[model samples]
Target: MFKIVKKWREQGTIERARGTGLENKKTTNNEDATLIQHLRAHPFTTATAAAQITNFPASRRTAQRRIRQISDFRCRVAAIKPFLTQQNKENRMGYAMQYLIFDQNFWENVIFTDEKVFQSSRNGKIRDFVLDSMKHILNKTIAVVDFPLMCGPGLVVGVPDCVGELMVD
Candidate 1:
């Protein structure tokens, strides 16, 4: 408070000087446009490669910063997904259509079950052990327990049993 008052009394204004830093010249409007064009043509190109083609050559770091300034684009790994063929799509559509015609009673006779397995390091008497030890054998186990069946209103009998399991390492 005292410092602020003192500054106001002497300068009559409370404003701090902006920090000093070298101005960016390598990424002018023209150079930035060219860099963007290069990136669009070859998205996987490295920053150093893109910088080399600009009118005013810049470092990889400078090229990256300029690209960030232009847009919110960022490099990332592509997500993996299963590829579905035309036959797969047609089969899925047919299955869905068959279910759509079924009434509430038909759905009540469907019991869906799923199981998941997990593996982790085990602890020993002396100290906790890691899986790196060759003697250790990771137990891959699955447990199945009865679960309450809840399907709409009244209790339905004779539901067909279906089981599915997913294992990950």
Candidate 2:
């Protein structure tokens, strides 16, 4: 309004006032660069540990804020995965290569089955009721005509002409 008009009349441009905060004096470019370098060296280091440096000594909160300002880095839990050795990789590759040579009919004949054992503890005795129940259910559903070929602990027997509707008990 009137103040704007008066200011505009006095000064050619209507820009806001500058240099009115402690944000600039908090940390310099050099300090930020040093902190970034330290973070790069030790990525898993906590803000509290990083703040203990002689050159860029600050509180944990301040250190975190500074780090955030530098990059889009955030803390996260590491995911667990199965450890595979060289032999494991080679074996996996060989298995895949063997399948590549075979036709689609080869896979149709293969009956893939997986079983998980659920352990339950009651009083002093460990009752494996879940595993027994699962096995019973599978046996009832799958009707074996000829001699069933057992692959592993949980069998993957190939039953010919018995791939109809499964009878669940």
Candidate 3:
């Protein structure tokens, strides 16, 4: 209370003074439009790469800040997908076309199997900036493990403390 009173007495108002810094030149409307276009064209590019590709005059950190200003944009872990060659793509398209005429009852009896290979490494995941509308395009998979049957006093049928064992099992 005393500090507030003293400050009020010293200054006429409690308003903050203007900052003594130059206005940001990198985040202008024209530069923002260019950055947005570059991101849309290459969503997986890093901030530094985007800045370098666009020939941005600002630092990489500034480029990152500008990216954050855009709405519905978020940095997320990249989905790992198998590399599909041209022949693989054509085969997948042909398979899809063959199944296009299947009715709901024909698809209802379909059984899909999920198989994932676990890797022991520290640098397996990759990060990327993505638009909100593009999230559904990414593939997401989770592995669920059920513990071996236990009939003892305490039957713990869940994941164990060891991550490596959980993945291996």
Candidate 4:
């Protein structure tokens, strides 16, 4: 597919201005060009986890060739992934997409919300926390938790100390 597009480009089928980084090139489509431009603007280390998430189809041999020839695809995927993640978090889209499709009768009038607090250590050298199954297993179990508190209109709200609050059995 890309080869065909490249031939078309070389044969003057598509015309576009080459950016400073792109030099002169041909692409499979406008989408491919967009993807590549995004990549060049945002380069990624070959080891980045988002690469796995994006599921780029080419193999190592193809990567070496393509990285040399089609640098933009690599750049676009890397740049856009982090931006996508940041935007999703800002919009609360990607965090927890849990759909609880349950029996209506049981779920009626049930509202669910949660809160959590954590204690941290000082050795927080800034690095991206790479997530994998093993990491999920290691630190995710919680023995203590809390839910949102509600007070009636004109009622005083105050924090209770170590005893927490009334435990709803």
- Candidate 2 per-residue lDDT over residues 1-169, each given as its tens digit: 8877888999966666676453455777777777767655554445555567626756677777877777655543323335657786566555545555778886677665444333222222221111212323233234311112244223234555544422111
Please give each candidate's TM-score.
Answer: 0.35, 0.34, 0.44, 0.20
- What lDDT score belongs to each candidate, Candidate 1 first? 0.49, 0.50, 0.57, 0.34
Output the better candidate (1/3) by lDDT.
3
Residue 6 of model 2, lDDT score:
84
List model 3 lDDT by residue over 52-92, tens digit each: 87787789888887888764667677566666577865665
- Point to the candidate with the largest TM-score: 3
Give lDDT: candidate 3, residue 169: 10
User: Which has the greatest lDDT?
Assistant: 3
Clashes of 4: 6
Report the C-alpha lDDT of model 4 over 58-157, residue by residue, as the tens digit: 4444443444454422221211112235554444432222323446774443434333222222322212221222222222222222222343111112
RMSD of each: 20.3, 21.3, 15.7, 18.5
Off by over 4 Å in 2: 1-23, 80-169
